[model samples]
Target: MSNTGAVMQKTLLGWIISGAIADKVVSTSCNLSIDQGLDLKLSKFWDIEEVTSSQNNYTAEEKACEKHFIENYRRNEDGRFIVKLPLKENRQLSLGNSRDLAVKRFYALERKLCQQPTLKTQYTEFINEYVELGHMQRIHETKLHNADTNKSFYFPHHAVIKERGNCANSPP
Candidate 1:
């Protein structure tokens, strides 16, 4: 069935109408249990499943993420959300070494910012405000390694100040 048996183009009365037979998304039926079995399967593209159950479909790790978010997230003094990143297990971070990539991207961003002084100012102010709001913290470059793993990791970040949905090249 997965490899694509005969595809059903449409249903005529109670019988399925057969069409092409290849690896594709199409409604099909077969009698697996019995020779006259009547079970129809309609592909929702990319073999994606529909959420039909009343209960949540969270995996253990996903449930753990939700639990972490629920337990740790809080409101700031101004009643704004001070949300923590939902991670799995005992607050463990498995970020790999990304200092090189981060530094490269940082230089690229710096170059772009230098070209636009007003944007640079706005971005700087935004980052400063983020730090002031306790949403972010300034860390020394010398102490950038994770204590447990002893690997340098960097969190990737970008800003999206939207007048409309464009990108970094445009003046957002």
Candidate 2:
């Protein structure tokens, strides 16, 4: 296979291992299959250090997802964070994959991460960074009304806005 082909194969393996394996974790029906393929698949999915420490803890779905993402996604070598952004110029770093797919994968990871309260912190932190970058802002105000039964609700639901930078002027 060509280099791109090899990378693509790795990427597909990573997604299958990480996403699907995570889905089936802790089920008894597949224990034997896991026993037969888990170790080898783990080797394919993680680096040596990660494999050493994490081998015993991962569910098959988690393993599959890990392998999938690692192969397709550009991650820090020390494994601190997965680069969630789409392919960028001047970075010389990419998963050698498509942007739309990365966004889809990110949505998946976001859903999974949000399930853990601690992981939600990462989102908040990223938002803060985005705010600093001026890429994110508060832009609107909602008018609240108490309808017939006397329940109050904001009109237009939750909306985005540009931050006014005035503490008193900020939305409640």
Candidate 3:
């Protein structure tokens, strides 16, 4: 398995254990506060110090980047950076913008998860497991599809690429 898969598995296991402990603690300690219960449960199975240190390192790196960008980048009257580029560069810029939007959405979701630390364990477990399962399902489907000779998949868009006699690189 890749490093990401291993990390997800470990995180899922941790959350499962933590959830079980939390359930037991809540059942037995009727008067205990949610925070106290969570603390007790996490202390038993989770390495709080390690997680905190990792989070601190991430935060520090982010702050450093923000500081650097603020000091180095200049904005125009529209409160944005102005750059001059040739018409040929527009396509590349559009593609880059799409990638940036995806990254922004991912970070926004992470920020939401951080804001809800109490539910972080369960949420992380669910999201990671769900995503991994989906990936596995897609791989399985692709393998099955590849085994079938009746269907075909195309690349470079259907309108752009065409099968012309013995030549495979011809445009439609």
Candidate 4:
């Protein structure tokens, strides 16, 4: 497999594990069946730690999402956020599609985050960084295409640190 494929697989796995952890559905015996040949078990506490670490290995936009989640939300004892369902025309629906419910929950969280004054600057900075990273990635991909190279480029960790430094030096 190419490096890009490996990176994408790792990213998808990280999202799966993070979502499971957040939903408090992570179990002591975790089984993953990707294909007929790939059956894996994640056991013990260390396995959870490994998955958490992988989730932290993210792009600028992803890091922003993680920051937003951590700062604006609190998990219950079960490690899941208590999200109330939206009322539909003064009546509560007993059943709803999971995907639609998830989208509503996400939008609710985003609205809560937007209400915070202290987080406003942070969120703006996050958006700026995310846009910058997107532009940089597109440029890099174009360069690679012109050079006829199949290599994929990820943002350097040092660039993140450098951006932090610039933010610190600048006035808000």
Best by lDDT: 1
Off by more than 4 A, model 2: 1-97, 135-172
lDDT of 2 by residue, 1-172 (tens): 2222211123422322212233333753312223436668787667654635767799976776676777777658798666443443355332333434544665776776668766567667777887999985753333212222233212221112344655887775
What TM-score fits each model? 0.41, 0.21, 0.21, 0.20
Writing each residue's lDDT as its tens digit, candidate 1 over 1-172 gives: 3444555543432536465566665865564331223333334332557546633778877777767878888999999877787644455556776777777888888988899888888899999998999998988756665344334467655554555547667764
For all candidates, what are the clash counts? 0, 21, 0, 0
In order, what lDDT does every prediction score? 0.66, 0.50, 0.47, 0.48
- Over 108-146, each residue of candidate 4 has an lDDT whose tens digit, in order, gives 656756786555566657668888888532345456446
- Top candidate (TM-score): 1
How far is 53's C-alpha from truth in model 4 (Å)? 35
Which pairs in model 1 have colliding backbones?
Answer: none
Q: How well is each residue in 98-151 modelled by candidate 3, as lDDT tens digits?
A: 333544665776776688775566666665786888842333655744543333
Root-mean-square deviation of candidate 4: 30.4
The whole-model C-alpha lDDT of candidate 1 against the native structure comes to 0.66
